[model samples]
Target: MFKNVLSENIWGRVVSEKEPVFEEINKIVESNSKLISKLNNEYHDHDSTIKLLSEITGQKVDDSVGVNLPLYSDFGKHLSIGKSVFINSNVMFTDLGGITLEDHVLIGPRVNLLSVNHPTNPEQRRGLIVSPITIKKNAWIGAAATVLPGVTIGENAIVGANAVVTKDVPANTVVTGSPAKVVKTI
Candidate 1:
């Protein structure tokens, strides 16, 4: 069950009365631009901040957590991660649905770690669908990859670049192509 913050929920809602709520949501993200940009400055000293974020997520990022990118989060729920994980640039996650990345995971650039999936029902889809996403330890998701909702990326799996993973990827396997399929077992 997800209890999204009011402003964060607006992105999932579109109603006349809720328009202001959505606007406020945008404002919160907008006002954080300076902080966001500064956060993206790879040259800045961010060990403390990154560690803080990892702590907030209930994840262990080990001693090497360095990268300059816009880290987005909602719900402020605890995200669990393992050690020696590398998260690259242009990574966007709506944790209103919760996201967990495990140890030794290598996430390439522009990887969209989505937690929400649209419902099959048209009306429900139009409203909103929320679910969590988990990437187990040693999972290497390639660049420009899009991982769908509620899917568990198994440990020691390799998801190829530009792949759209709509289902679970088995551990110790390599997968590519849209709606990724297993290429071979590692």
Candidate 2:
């Protein structure tokens, strides 16, 4: 059985949950988890929390980026945030592949951006696939929305509350419901 799965864009390399690469990724997760714990528990300084997030993610998060506390992520290094982004509380980012939020993006409370998934085949169920999720500039994701792997929300698009986004959303569109269908174009 083929244990290695080829990821399209996340890493552009062969990946397998059973391989050493997954182990390394797990270590990153573990370390970041501790830092995120501190970030959630200690809430005196917002700047310090952002600094810790930047350190864990290895990205220069702009000062203008406002992320409310109690955010969670499986891997922080794979996340990249653009300028003037507002992420509300209780957001979960599973960025094993990558999750990019462009400038002026607004993510509402309890939103989930996930980028890692397993294959359907039980024999290869342990195999993991990583895909990048991109929310373009000025997009707004409503409260409790879940953006799945490889999804790209286009510029100025709006995902309605509690929507489960499984595919790419067009630019200047409003999407709602499970699987996220475009209801109107802005």
| Collision count for each candidate, in order | 3, 0
CA deviation > 4 Å runs, candidate 1: 1-38, 41-43, 48-63, 72-78, 120-122
**lDDT to native, each model:** 0.67, 0.85
Listed per candidate, the RMSD to the true structure in angstroms reads: 4.8, 4.7
Model 2: per-residue lDDT, tens digit, 65-94?
898888898788888888899999999999
lDDT string, candidate 1, 1-186, tens digits: 233445444334323323465465455445444445545554545676576554444344556655446565543342455567787877766564557777678889888888755556655544445566789888999998988877889989999999999999888999999989999999
For candidate 1, the TM-score is: 0.71
lDDT of 2 at 185: 95
**TM-score of candidate 2 on Cα atoms, chains taken together:** 0.92
